[model samples]
Target: MSSCNSAPKRVGNKVKCNLSFFDTIRKRPIGPSGYQIGYDDLVALKLYSNFYHYEIDKLEHDSHYGGIFNLEFSLDGKLLVAACEGKQVLLFDAANQKQINSVDSAHQNCVNCVRFLNDKHFATCSDDTSIKIWDIRKLKSCLRTLHGHSNWVKNIEWSEKDNVMVTSAFDGSIYAWNLKSHSENNMLYDKVFLMNGLMRMKLTEDGSKMVIATTNGYMIIIHDLNLATLATDLRSFKPSLYRLMQISDQCYPVATIYNYLFSPTRKRNRIEFIDDFPNEAEVISSLQIHPHGWSVVSRNINGEENEEWTSVHDIQSRDPSDYENSFMYIEEDIPDEPEPEEPPNQRPTDLWLGYISLDEYSNHNRDPSQVSQNIWENNFQLPAMGILNSGLIGVNASYNAYFQQHPEQRNKVITNLPRMTHFIKEKNVGKGYIKELCFSSDGRIICSPFNRGVRLLAFNNQCQELSMCVPDNPQQLKTIVEMNDYHKDIVVSCKFSPTHYQLVSGCLGSEIKWYQPVV
Candidate 1:
């Protein structure tokens, strides 16, 4: 194991830091009955608090034990729900984060995605080749199951303002559902079979355009999407003209802009795109556009190959001639730096882990048109911190060498990793991979799925372990909390409330865990 001393230290308020157990004191917070607060809860409180004056209640669980692929919190952050592989839909009270109710067979098979249509209603899609709508008040059954797709439903995106939702399936088909009229519109793009299959899709801020990512690494851009126009006459939904661009030969392109699209490469420390520019690659992963559509954040995938590094990139457009010269073109106001060198004996502090984008939960209530005009102002300028060492190692040697051919000055423009406030590790929980991590609306707490449970870390600028006590013996520090009651199998997906401190998570065994922070 690498020595803890090798880890970087925080430099004032800019970087959050964590301390070793032996380095702490014994004056942790005491609860109302004068009892020492639970260790796990105490840790959560500290992680979420600025003064460490608070305490978390205890570990809570739900009835199911399957691996969850996704979870979402309501807009108010009071309710948490999830879709499980076991074909179950689970619910919980966001205030206490405990299981309140669930539907054992929300679908005939695995539920892949869950989305909220509004405060009282939500929708889910599953491997059973259908989508079901449910109400939070009645958890025992679904309100309706919408059928059409002949394959697993991979994802669902809804526009509450338009009262329409889009569902994409494994069969390369896209279906539009109208909440008001209860109608469906099928998308039949020209040359659809040439693009392997539909992998994912993104709607423009006002729902006027959709950037569809296909399995063949091409982006199909469709415009003029109107349910009213389409429902009245089916042909109205068929766009007469569509724009297509080749992004990758076969790799899945994850994010896109009006003029640019982002795709992944097997290379270490970089993501290339299919845009015309001085540079076409940046170091990022799981790139997601902000709800407002002007900015994007990296979901920051960590692994041994890339040193567990990830960063957020701001998209700004600039005059091409400003960066042009006889020999090459370059972005202005950005400095060049050497790529980070992987430590010979370094190991990822967190391994087999997954990530969820802040874009997924941030600014859900705000009008997409008003997010921040300055969001795209910087125009792809790397964050000031530069590339960070996530302590994970794994690199594609061939791809790395090929991309390395670009001048160091071009490859040098990249962002750094976000500061890690604290690390929460559970001993008894098996080392099953974590699929997603989410932060509460206020940015106070973050939660990620665990092997058989979910782990939460309350976060703020302060490091409170200085006064908290560590167990007298090493073995005594088994875990901060054991959330195994939620699922008997591995937990996979999770989401946070857009406005509250509540959380929702799911597992592979098809169970859901709803957790709330109790002070």
Candidate 2:
């Protein structure tokens, strides 16, 4: 309250003095993506916790302002390609992450996907319902534009064996085209296999089979070439349903036949003559074996009877279990005597024959009690019932019942069987969906760029800790740099070079970032 200049000279500075103050705020270094790289010479090694001791070389901005959608590398791993939703496809050098060439307006709409068929060429599909083939040598223009799909083309697969390409569309059809023969005059494909209601189509390893996953929750296996052959063979044969009947004992029936009415449809019973019988027979029983499929079983029946019966002729004895337990009998009349003649072919009268039948026997030469005599000795041998012609139907019905009851679990056992190759989730790197992922040719390291940050994952977790040395500060070598650079936006796609240890990331901002390992 004294003079204005003399007021701040109090002991211990009861009031704060504004004469001077030490600079307490430390400035942070600017990083590649406008991030602050905080460091200290004395505690730099201790502070750089998660970062490697590498130096940032260069940074480049992508051409498009929209978001990146997909990325792929050529088979040789030397060239890297990226697709932007802004209708551009850029090819870059894998070694140095340098922009080699780019295609503008590659698609009328957003380029949703890209895939490399080989070292020289690749394919791209778009929402414009078109697929374009590109040659790496001539980066200026597309080699061919495949047109057929009416709606958005969701996926495209290039065949390695033949010059064939397959595409799936939202219009619920799959089209296969011969790329080699494609021309303006011959634009329409030579062969078309129409999958009217299928949602997706994937070819097997050899292209011999096509697995079509339908929206109705069924997988149809189509053998395109073989199906026609099978159909032709099937049309040449006549399929008949046959049955057997039990006739009386006195008639000495030569043949026992049962008539079956064929019904093709479930609701309508349209009776059709299945088989004919020689004698009047009565159907005692009928069995519906297969519910939805067809089957055929045949047997032979011979009315041969000998004293030493080797066969048993009872219908019940034909049970599979009876065959194992039945006894073997030699001629019963020739009592335990070793005769010079080989005991009359112990032809057992009870032998349950199948399919064919023998004639009746009228010869009254043997003893009346010896009703079981060799068929050759008797002028005519009565045809015994060949293996009982029992028909069972309705097998497919049972299979459908089981499938409907536990649909999810029934196929679990069949689908989970190990295959030659499969994809498994590693680490979740970003908040958004992984639009695209590709492995380096050798498959050592995997680089995934998410919406937030790009991640470098080591496939083989075997490495020793080397001395931590910063580019400028040796003392800061002990510190690590935390790798959490990615932020809010999604990283739509990422790819690794097959020839080098470099990675490129395409983010939602339509920006592509290049990353290389410190080693």
Candidate 3:
């Protein structure tokens, strides 16, 4: 292992962190006894926190699990299921951390994901272009198998409010399955919508909206979906404009498309607040909304002021009244603190020197002998939204020296040269972009799958450090832990235990490891 206390990178006065300090607790192999766990191509982690540490458990193998693509737990948290690349579903007893059952050929091809409907009923999607609902009680058979997509089924989500399930596939089609009412011959799902490269889909807390992430870097937003009427309108649902369609008589689904850019050209330090939609000036890698659906947490595609690292932001409507109320309550409850006095020998802070343009100089009738210092002050004129700027300008040092040498020719040379007011961004940097990220239900802890490791971050919402109070500095998102190197290759997925203080991680090396914070 490398040094646990590895130094952070410094860019200007900012600190960039590549978290690499978490201690390994234990490793669980997923394949046969003779095979090496590190090279096993494990794609997902489905371990439960109920099992005590030091329990060495392995899922039984048939041929070999091509790779564990996704893992899920039953509702009661007693059973663990692993979706494998060999179209297999392995069931394990969570209490003892041992394999109890296995379905060798659950699907025609590799299984991509597994989600539980209830304790005994669970659903799995596969690359074979089908979805299967299985009951653990009847180990040999599947309850229902749904097929519609022409490409691989990538994701599946259950909506409890409507008693329906939504699935997305690689072919860009989305299907809705009405659990209460199936078609004549046990046809599980009815077609809902179609779009290209729909890789992932997540439903909001209230089931009013669905956020779809595509392979082509577009986020599809579907709003005002009436769950009560979804089953009835499945057949007549159409995507078009102007003339009233069949669903228009009832309720039409409102959809919007945002072209998400992974690399935006604006400066990172400037704040952009939007009231309706995201500004689209930053590369958004992953997006998660708060439980209330009022706030959005997004991971920027690239890390600024730091090398090979990224940052996250909490974007919400700015309510000045909320801050004022908070400030009033805090003032009434606490005593005032005294301000520290500055030392006599301390010099004033240095300010960036800027030159006024010829037009402004001519209008103001400025004196030539007096030196002007650039002083930026608080000029609050309402926060801007969806605005982009390059930032501060950079001029050639040799040009400045040449103007200084020839004082008489300075005005002539300055007049000829173009005046730049904004800064230009640097090209292509920050290779360590996050591919997948998940936050806990409470929004305190974030787990993201990075190259060969998992990044655990703690959000500093209170702004604890004094230096972090700087207005132009980066957000107070800190990497609290890093789990890496033990896995042979890239980590594909990670999840937090809903009921325990543990995290399960899955890697491409055919291994699933359960990690707990060292207390």
Candidate 4:
């Protein structure tokens, strides 16, 4: 009965509607609070919040035959030398990165250290417990082998003054040699200065003293030949007079003595004084090393310039009781003060403050103008502190962490170092540790070698890194290139060419890699 009224079923007042597919997919209109995002919109967001860009470039070059160990440049920046575990020293033309010469069989074992004394001569020490001096001009062994140490020679330093050389060994001994008369027969000039223990040695700039780092964590000072000798003769033919003789001929073995300068260290550090003949030794000063284990280089001031020569007076012999009432205050004659002149347009920028002193001015009878001038000149004495401050500021600006925190300050400091134009990381070369690093005199480029490759990094800061991974339709995009492959290996050492754009690196595998910078 209901089938007959199917048409009448819709008369119940309930209706159903269907929307088209196009209407469902249609985009909504822009609103004042909504954003319209394109590809650039996403990129802008990324750059503002997360993305970074670094550009880098790689150059292909000749590969090293073996792993690199150490690299260095000559003092004058003309030669780039590499010490390879292959028992050879390779010299390269710095300008072109071409192999100039090779010293085959330069060492019996791995060359651990190499240094050039001058443009013509250099020295190399090896694990074979020997050191060889070579003549760059002859490209042959210099016929002088420093062969005093019984164990591995760890380090060597040539004196800036004479032909004197100092070498330290793992055998806990140090030998000072005179290379001026260097021959096989005269291997060592002095009895190994027997540091009494194993130690590392560093000589001063003037070669007047040496600082010795002992295995016992003690730093000892060895005064140069400037000290006087103290001697007491115990044996005499007749003890007749029982004389208490003062031998003026016997010197005191030391000039002016002062307390040891204490510095922070990262280990248990102590300065010990030792006397060999008398078997006297004492710890003069002790200091704890800082947590960072960073070594500090300090310049010592000994009043060399302001020292006034005074006559020796027997003040101790004078009885204070005799002159207690009438003690006279003696004054030295003061020098005349010069007229003050106008400051130069460009004053010495790097002045050092040495010492400051204040003394009382006395005038028995003098011209008012002269006295005023003297007062003005002597009123305040400031040591070369200004020079020291300027030097320190320059150093801090270039290398200090504080400067790195403030970009503006860093830029200002960098402006002062007009020589440092750019810095770049070399890509693709050796596989070893960079033990030593040196730049050419001109500082146009840099060289480092590690493991199997010798890398030449550009000095210009124009290189950029390319991004290889960017998401499609992402909110932001960025690119980054890492040049870590160039230094993948343990690069114990690397050096730049002295005269050219060449770099050399040495590896533990006894091979040397020479690289030329591609312009």
Candidate 5:
């Protein structure tokens, strides 16, 4: 089912690319006979995006699909599972692109995430507000259905080290299920992580740190999941830190991860970017943590500019020792509107400084949607994709002290960290949402969803090119190669093979394109 084509029928005299992928070894990008590059993996990947240009018109395509929400490759890379807007979960043999099994209407609503616990076992979560564990061996029925969220369950992360299942959703809550207990009542712990617009959470491969992407346009990071590694850098918002993501006066979100450092309390720690980073625009639509956990790749759209950028950021892990603990709920960032002067005896309604017990404020944000709406409106017409760190959740001393320490930054919103190292990428993705993105196992490339197709963004071939002091110039780093001509509809999900140099992607056109390099 594969053939070696020297060039696609409609080859361009000048292929669109920034860096020469194979120039060192070959005068021409592709040898007349086909990929002759000594590196098999590099040739396979290069050909998937570059040589396919010669066969642009001949690219094989499948029948229409309702819409694909996400795709996942099993750790062994022998199997692929797709979660679809059609309410169907599909399993396929990775090598041949053949349907192995499928569960139609797997969820009452759109299935958002499909994760492989192992080659034979997998998990799925949906807008139906429930997470189901399935035995791929029996696709007909799920092994267990865990329900605890009050809204759409956007994502699920498994911590193999602690045998715990973590789920986060639009409900602004994170819940952990102890699989170790092996009981129907396995839901271990639950807590609201944000006031609203919480959409996705990702665990680094080691599960040491977790990053969250929210609709309010922020990235939240939690460090030392199992507390396996302790970070001693405890100066949260210490003035010595370099600033980056500043957009006028508003803060952007970087991350908010609940640390297990405090044991029973699960003390929360976060970075509030009152503006700092590689770039601006945080209405982040998609996020993926790198396998090694040092960084994360996130996609954001500037609704105001009608543009999107995929950014890579270092995970700035801060130690929780600055103050034992204090968690606070922040619904409003600094608004451009002049602050309303408060009566001598009146508490600021928008600025709830008096630690009115967390529960009393909890009622103020019962409806997630309203909280987000009121937050943005009260702050100002937030016009783009971004995140700023807010307050943590614990005691008042630490909370008030956090504010007092940075009196000058009091008006600036708090979110994720500043000092976003690595990369910030922009693409001419005209219209539609880029809902999902992922990093290959080696972390050398990013499989990012483009408008109607997909983009393959290369990082350092070795992935350790962190020597630059300033962010790389945005003039096309020659890293992102588009495999876009193939898909006719907005591509929603894609994944790289963990076991092979293969790729599988699904689109709103209901077509799934599997790219396997033919030597």
Candidate 6:
């Protein structure tokens, strides 16, 4: 069938047209090792902080009763699954924003997290202390029911590398279920690691490293995802979150109660449960590791004033020094140089008395290398990080900004977690704490829940305000897009589409709003 200008003509096993399209005849076989994500085809999201939501009166509950807790996009970006507090698994066709199917009573208790095993199969964990696997085609019954956790299972991560599904629960336990064999095998399924006060766990897209947000006020990172090593050390693990904080005293989960009086160096800035500290449990209940696995977007909840802040925490990277000097410059285009003349300028061998005049040396020669020696992370014990939005200056601003007029574009910064919250004048969402946030596929944007809306933030896109990884101030986001007035209640969950420019969010009012740009 054909028209002269726009028609398909078949001749000798070939199709021809004025404009033609063809896929590769020899398509490479996609294997267990996944390919990289191409962000070129993605769309733009423009709802910034000043953006207003157009309210529409409506009363429709996607979940039977409670609010939606967490959601996920499938690998193909065609399906989305929502874990609701009502114990329902709501599925939708993402492209059309149509409800495809629903798993009523998906869990015995509140479903906490949903993860995709593939396009048609997915996994979900819940407060019922179990994890279940289901095939989208047949939702009447789950394919498998995994039972292990003693308490509420809140996080579920499937490791493509290990072919195991890992789950974390309120009982401070993490177990892995092997999927390769399709049968429970002792070696593949078991407790890989354990820790107290764990609220959630996340893995990078590669399944290389895992980040855990805990109630103990620590952002725990396990290197190389060496769970076997973690399983071994589980015996020596002490809940001495305090002693560890005193020891790694200079590590992740660093926070500042307030910047005016409390020095950034004070250990009290570290989040953790302390009977002495007020509020309640110092909990970091929600977090997501960047797809690149170099950074984490988390809500650092501090007991002080019960503040919550959205922060970007740079974790350990391939090059240890990449994170060591949060204030140093890192040029993405520059080839890895030999760190340049690090060996203290060869003590000019011609000195006769073997003693050079102190005045003869440059400040660089006289003083220790500011970055190499890293006085901040080493001596003073301060977090070298950046914040996105915060009520407090110290939390919202990067310390480097205090010194450098414009800090170099380093990749990491650690600011006061709770201090970086966006201050809303009205009855805001979570005081200063962010309920939940998700990162875009490229690790460049974050859609976090604000008071009654969602904040779409782009980071380090070379914009002066947020170009520096450790921006002097909290406006480290490349741009801010806010969407409000549409939902009647506070937004609870927000996530970016992996392949498209669309955004989806859920609110405490039991609604799921699909946001796509209108041409």
**Best TM-score goes to which candidate?**
5
Please rank every candidate by lDDT, starting with the best: 5, 6, 3, 1, 2, 4
In model 3, residue pairs whose N, Cα or C atoms come closer than 3 Å (at least 3 residues apart or on different chains), thus clashing, are: 41-509, 41-510, 42-510, 391-423
State model 2's lDDT: 0.39
Task: Give a tens-digit lDDT track for model 6, residues 344-385.
Answer: 443212101111111221111222122111111222222222
| Candidate 5 similarity to native, TM-score | 0.66
- TM-scores vs. true structure, each candidate: 0.47, 0.43, 0.53, 0.40, 0.66, 0.61
> Quick one: ranking by TM-score, best first?
5, 6, 3, 1, 2, 4
- Locate the minimum summed-lDDT window of 10 residues in model 6: 349-358
Better of 1 and 4 by lDDT: 1
For model 5, residues 1-519, the per-residue Cα lDDT tens digits are: 544343333223222333355453564555555544334444434444452321212212334236777899888888888887667888788767777777887987778888877667788998676898999777779988787676667787878765667788755566677654554565445452444445567777776677777554456566555422222232222211112223233232222112222222344333332123345565666788777676777777654645667777767454545323332333334445344465545422222211122233333333323321111232322223222223332223544564576443433332333535445456644344446787776666677776665666654432222332224442222343556656677777888888776777777776677765432
**lDDT tens digits, residues 1-519, model 2?**
111121111112221222111211222233334322322221222211112212222224544546677777787877778777677888877765567788888987777677787778899987676889899888688888887765556566555544567777545455667776756654454223433233444444344444443322223333322322323322211111111111111110111111111112211111122111111212101011011111110111112211110010011001233223222122112224344353464422322333221111112122323321111233322234343211111123443464466443221211111111111122333222224444333332233342255433321122111112111211111101123343235665666565655556667766565554321
In lDDT terms, how accurate is model 5? Answer: 0.56
Q: Which candidate achieves the best lDDT against the true structure?
A: 5
State the C-alpha lDDT per candidate: 0.43, 0.39, 0.46, 0.36, 0.56, 0.54
Supply every candidate's count of residue pairs whose N, Cα or C atoms clash at under 3 angstroms: 28, 49, 4, 59, 51, 24
Q: Write the per-residue lDDT of candidate 4 for residues 398-456, one digit (tens) a residue.
A: 33454355423222200000111122222222211223433333322223332233332
Off by over 4 Å in 2: 1-65, 183-434, 443-451, 456-483, 486-488
- For candidate 3, lDDT tens digit of each residue in 89-191? 8887666656788898898776777888876788998766688988899979898888776656777888876778888775557778887787877766666
Model 6 residue runs over 4 Å out of place are: 1-63, 181-188, 239-281, 318-434, 460-479
- Evaluated at residue 510, the lDDT of candidate 3 is 59
lDDT of 1 by residue, 319-390 (tens): 334223312222323224335576645522322212211232122223323311111121222112212122
Candidate 1 deviation (Cα RMSD): 18.6
Worst 10 residues of 4 by lDDT: 237-246
Candidate 3, which segments miss by more than 4 Å at Cα?
1-55, 58-63, 227-436, 461-476
Better of 1 and 3 by lDDT: 3
Evaluate model 2: give its TM-score. 0.43
